[model samples]
Every structure is written in C-alpha cells, then in structure tokens.
Target: MNIARPLLALLVSATLLPDAVAGSFSFGLWGDMPYEKNNDAQTTAAVIRSIDRSDVAFSIFDGDIKDGSSACTDEVFSRTAKTFNAMKAPMVYVPGDNEWTDCHRKNNGGWNNLERLDTLRKLMFADGRSFGRRKLTLEHQDAPFVENTRFHKGGIVFSQVNVAGSNNNRVLDEKECSTKSARSAADCEADNAEYAARNAAVNRWIEESFAQARQRKAKGLVLTLQADPGFDLPETEELDEAKTRGWNRPESGYKDLMDTVIRETRAFDGQVLFVHGDTHVFKLDKPLHAPLDLLPNFTRLQTFGSPNNHWVHVTVNTRRPEVFTVRPVMIKAD
Candidate 1:
C-alpha cells in the first residue's frame, strides 16, 4: 500500500471514532412492565417502537419482564427474549426477582427459584452477544455469572450486574422464607448460598469495572441493575408499608456491594451513574446517605416501572461534568 493512501485512511478512521464524532451518545432504559393485570403488552410494544425510532447506542431492560404475580413459565422468558431480539438496538437485560427469586410463589408455578434462574441465564444470555438486530459483543463472567456483563462505549465503562430485589434473595426468617409457595427451609438455605456466591461475583465485577475505567481513562462509568437498594426506607416498618425494607432498612443484603460502590465512586475521578429499577418509581437524585454527607459525583437514575408504560432516554456527554442526563418518554396507549 502507498504511504499516502494509508495515512489518509488512518485520518478517516480517527474522525469516525464513536466518541470523536460527537462526544456524546444515548441509551434507553426500562423495566418492570407488561404486567398481566395492566394490559401492558400494547404499551410495551409502543415503547419499543419509540425506542427504535430514536437514535441510541443500545437499550437496557433493567429487569422484571412481567409482573410479580405472573407465572414464571418458560414461555414468559422465551417470549420476552424474542421481543428483545426484535429490537433495532441491542438489549442488555439484568435479572429481576419476579422472573427468578420470587418464582417460588404458588401462583408462579412453584419453580425452584435457583433452577428458574439457571433457565433464564441459558435462555437470555447464552452467547457473548447482546439481543437485537444490531448485536454488540459483551464481556461476561464465567459460568453462572454469565449474565453479568461489561462493555465500553462513548469513552465510558458500562456494566450490568445480576443484583435484584427480594433482599437480593437473602431470606431473613422462617415466615419470610417459607410462608409463600413451595419453598422449604432447605430451599431457603440453598437460595441464600446461591445469593452469597453471586453477590461475591457482583462485587468482583464492580471492582473490575472500576479498574477498567481507570486503565482506559474513561470519562465516566455506569452501573445498571434491577434493585432499588432501599435507600429511602424508614427505620421501622409501618402498618401501611406493603413491602419489606430489604436492602437498607431493617436488613441489608446489599451492604457489601454498597460499600464497594461507594468506595470506588469516591476514588474515581470521573462522574459515576447508578441506574436501577424494581421500585416502580421514576426518580433521579443523589441518594447516597453514607459518610454523613452525600457523594457529589454520584448520581442515581430510576427508570419508569409498571403502570408507567414509559422508558428513560439517557444521554451521556463527555463534555459535561455530570456526564449523564435522563428524560422519561411516555408510551401512549395503542
């Protein structure tokens, strides 16, 4: 090849680099939808259509393909996978309690929660590529942690960990663990064992993400999962409180993970974004209450969940100190 021609090609490639083109990119986020009682199929489809119409690098379905009350049948996962595969952009999914941990409920077909989780992993995360017509290669942890994924885009490190609600699957008591469905003390014990192993893997993934961010000198980092982590729960349970304060109030399955994130975020020089669902709330705030003062560089984004029929449009701009901006896109009834 001629030297002049080679130099010209290098220049063109440099100009076409993803971050160099605009210094910004966008992604979509949504979860806890298509609830059976809410007739959410049409709305969910509309939201997918809206995402396809927009220009985003990829979309993350944070978790909860169906409502908590729905059965965790094979068809549920298969249908959801098919839907995700049809999207124009890659869809990266995190695990949700409704699909796995809570599958032990009698109404949910009395699935062995861990077994259901294995089925989900094989069905949704069998390969290294993400779901969609335009696939993106992702780095996954070995074996059971295959769903934990990390990728880089627009000069930022992005990761998805399998952390979920239901106290991250740590059953607290006999009543809390065995009252529902076909679960026994043995099953609860097994569940907690699985939780411990996976929790360790999650922590490793977080550390690895931060290390990669530093090595790459990325402008920002994003951690996406499916649990709210109960940052705002009251100290004591009230009569009106329908849900248990699993992650941060009376008990905390997420203490180790939370500690890791806080430490790494504090150490990192760039902005940090934490995105989660499972609370069915739309919120954006700096909600970390540790160290007596909140972390100024850390931001939390909660996507629109069930009965909301909406998706969050997130834009990451390396030029901005905050790095991430979120907007909710409402899906109209079809």
Candidate 2:
C-alpha cells in the first residue's frame, strides 16, 4: 500500500481529544546508531534495556541508524527497527541521511534511495499504532513526507516533524547512473518532472504541519529531525559554507519547516523544543536566533550519536500552559 494512503487512513480514523492532559510524560531520545566499531546489536540492546528501566513515556531515536555512509540492506534496516521497537515504551524515529541519502553506495545495497525511503515508510510508520490509540499520520496527505505527527497527551499537544540532516539527496548508485545515461531524452525529462512533483509535495507537507499546530493551539511544539541546525555561525568559513549550501542550508525545506513551527508557536505563547543528532555530540544548547520573547521556552536536545549512543528523558507538565524539561542520560557501557 502507498505510504500516504495508510497514513491518511490512520489519521482519519484517529480520535482526537481536545481536553487531554499533558501530565508527567517521560521518553528517551538519542541518535546515530550502529556505527562501525561502537554500534553492535548487543550494545544497542543494552542501551534499550537501560531506557526501559528509566520509566519514560516513550523513546525517540533522533536519526543516523548507521554510519553516515554505509550499505543499508533490508536485513540491517529491519534488525535496527526491531531493536528500536523492543524499547519498553513507544518509540518514534526521524530519518537520517545515513539511513537514506548516504545509503546509495554499492556496499549499501546500491538501491534507489527513494525506494529505500519508501521501504522505511512502509516498515516504520505505515500504521499509526506506534503513537498510541489516537491515530496520527504524517503532515502531507498525498506523500510519505510527514511534516509532523501530533497527539494530545496530558492536555498538551506533542508534535514531531520529519526533517533529516541531508536534503533527501544522495549520490546515485551505479544502476541509477547507468540507467539515466541509457534513458531516452523524453524519459529523462519525465523523471525530472516527477522529481519536481515529489519535492513540491514534501514542501507543502512541511508548511501544513506548522499551520496545523497553530490551529490546534498546541501548548508546546516538539520539533524533531536528524540534522542539527547550525547554532554557531562565525566558526570556520568552510563549515559556514557547508552550512549555507546544500541540505545544510538554513532556508532549505527542513529549516523552513522549523521556522514555520517556531513562528506559529509564538502566537500561542507556547514552547518550542528542537531535537536532533548529526554531529554525534550529546549536548543541549539554545540556537542563536531562538525567539525567547515570543516563545520563551526553547531547547535543543542532541543526544549521544557516536562514542556513546545515549537517550534523552523529557518531562512534560500540561497545565493551562505546558512545561517541558529535558535531561540527557547516557547508556553506561556494560
């Protein structure tokens, strides 16, 4: 089944509770898993066991299920998903470049990155059950591109967006390269048109997610993605250039999605919490341009991704307004 259709079905059937209370909900958040040396199944399992014992509401795996660039076969991806599913609490995942964009290498199965993405949609988010009884789907109705997944918990709206580090662009595999070369001129043009259509759909989904958050009067917005938005601007010119261009560019689709959420949440007098993992550093630092006055509550929780794959514990208290407190907990090596 198409990803959007299942998502739509789930969303349409989901029950919405306006008076839901966002009491004390705890969840684990982490990123960048299965690195070459540090991320074995045993290590991943131990991390999950720790989270289960922590008594979290749910767990959110930030991204990077594998090294930045590696072959991601069905078996590998499935195993990783299973490991996450094994968490004691419900788990949500945002895509990372490693799982999709960087998986174009021959060793990485050399499959169409888009196709792998579709597979992910089918496996990880095809059904809305992961989010609990209330049905939730991606923001976009026609595409698997989900801007945010929203649910009411303890009277507060908890929302998540699907923004990854890489702009869903990866180097083409040999087959894709060769096929493009052998394709007729008309076929190439047609392919370009399709690409444009998909890109537009993704952009629309992003815009709609923020719009919905505003309409829903969300007390606090939890925006989760894979890449870390550049918090430091005047560091190195090379790094600055990389941040300014390509997928890392601030105004790109992902940034636009976040900016919309940040701006819209301001009108509701809510908090904006951003979570991501790309630099493999576990730290919490507010962005340089966070709108503190409009949205006084803001946090960037990027948990362990490399040396130590850790998870974040977030506590949400839903009173008239909502409060979000985050604590990063590392998975002790056994």
Candidate 3:
C-alpha cells in the first residue's frame, strides 16, 4: 500500500506496454505447406530457419500446416506444433480445411471430419496460447477456442479467425450435403448445423474486434483468416448479378464475413489490413464490389503457401500514413 512502491510498479508496467515495446514491429506469415513428402522435409527446414532468423516480433502461419492429401493424425498436429516451436519468435496458427473440414475426402484417409476438427482444437489449442518456443499472451474471443485470438502491437489490433477456404467448410446445396463427402446424410446435416452456428460466431467475432479497435482508437486493424474469400471473382458471377446465388465460386459462405469487414472498415477512420492464406499464392491488392467498391483504405494480402512455400514479412506502423508494408520472402530451398 506504500505510495513509492505503487508508483514504481506503475512505471514498470508503463515501460512494458506492448505497443511501446513493439514499435514498428514485423511478423512472418506462411501456410499450406509441407506437401510432397519427398521434399517437404527440406522445404520445411529452410522456411523454419528463415523465420527464426528474420527477427520479427512473431509469426502467424495463416493455416494448412500440412498437405490436403496427408492424414489428419495426431502426428500431423504434434509435428506441426514442434515445427512452430522451432521458431525463435512466437508463432500463431489457425485451422485450415485440410486439417479437418476436408479430411473426409477419400484421399485424406476419410476420417470423420468433425471429429478430426475436435481433435485438432484439442491438440493445437488446448493450452489457449500461441505456439513457438517464445510464446505471448493472447486474448481468445471464446475461452479455449484458439481460433479467435486478439493481440495488439504498434497501436494496431491484430486478430486471427478460423475462417478457411473450401467454402469456409460450409455445406451448400443438397448435392454437397448428400453425396459430396464420405459421411452419411445425417452427418452432413450435423455439419451444416455447425457451419451455420460457427459462421455466425465468426461474423460476430469480427465485428467485435473492429468495435474494440475503434473503442481503443487503434490506428489500424489487421484481420488474419485462412481463406481468400475470392474477392476477385469475375464481374459476371451470378452472385454479383443479384437475384441469384453463386454456386460456382467460394463466395456464398463468406458473404457474412465480407459484409462485416466492409461495414466495420468503412465506419472506422483508419486503415484496414486483411491477411489470408488459402489459395497458396502471394497477392496484395484492393479488391471489392460496389457500395464499397475497391476500398482505398483496405488492403487484402494473400500469403505464400504450398509449392511456393515462402513467408511474408509484414511491418506495421500506426504512425505512418500507410499502416502496413508486406513483402514476400521466398525461402532458399537448396
């Protein structure tokens, strides 16, 4: 209760504030990797070494720590966790469809995808902390649900969501619900229910993250997801035509998320950085449709994954007019 002791504690806490300690921090992003078992060992080793040497604040592997064709076994999760732990910086990972949603595919061992997902959550996230030898405290949107996490750095709010590609794991149309998977109709129906509820939860979490950013007057907000959401779809898409549903592209399940992103980004007075990895290509641009067409203040960055098997170095600076600068660093495989 002594005044001197309390003042000294306050001074120590102020000095350790995340933003001040993280001024102009950088991070690495990678995903959809370790495919082609023959060469993945070398590639994975090289990429991990690169990240460990990059001297970034931390790294976020957007998703897909393994190939689609691999078995979603306990080994996969544990090995990936070990790989993350090898990084000198803290590592953050979200789920990819390959890890669970699409595990029912015959090529992927035809496991019960839902059960796979449950196991994944338990293995990678049960501790409710980020991966890597160096770990950081994270705020999970829902306790024990590591998919939704929030952290702050350089006055920007950085959040990760478990929204992945393959239509965000949604079961659309009777065809998909009935014959598209190894599971039975009843299993598909149950999956559809999960999709509905989880999608709603993801949308709410996104909105809440934006709200928190605004409340804190963060200079910008960075949202990391595992799906590209296909914002670059052709103008002739049925979804854009109105009065029709677009079944050709992966946009249906992402409409809610896209709407929330557009709405909150528009309302906020600062920049918005959207990062995703599904699609396994590195792309950076502004792509959107009307009413919020091509948001100048919004930037969409797709990270390197799979065959490319690289990582992105992202620098965040809230004091600058441009909130982010992202660069692709292709790891040397030799």
**Predicted candidate 2 versus true structure: per-residue lDDT over 56-163, tens digit per residue:** 767777777788546777776777766766666677777777776545455666566666677877776665555322223433344455423555455355555555
- lDDT tens digits, residue span 128-242, model 3: 6788888978887674345688887777888898887778777767677546457777777877777887888888888988898898888888899898776565556456522
The deviation in Å at residue 163 for candidate 1 is 0.7
Q: Of 1 and 3, which scores higher on TM-score? A: 1
lDDT of model number 3: 0.79
Candidate whose lDDT is highest = 1
TM-score of each: 0.90, 0.73, 0.87
lDDT of candidate 1 over 1-334, digit per residue (tens): 5799989999998778777346798999989988998888888889999999998889998999988887899999899988999999998888888999899998888889999999999998989999999999999998979999999998899999999888899888889886767898999999889999999999999999999999888889999999878666455645222244334345678877887998999889888989999888899988765436778989988889878889999998998888888889878966
**Candidate 2: where is the Cα deviation over 4 Å?**
1-22, 131-141, 146-148, 170-208, 236-255, 288-295, 320-322
Ranking 1 against 3 by lDDT, winner:
1
lDDT of 2 at 258: 49
Q: How many residue pairs clash per model?
A: 0, 10, 0
Give the Cα RMSD of candidate 2. Answer: 10.6
Clashing pairs in 1: none
Give Cα distance to truth, residue 24, candidate 1, Å. 0.9
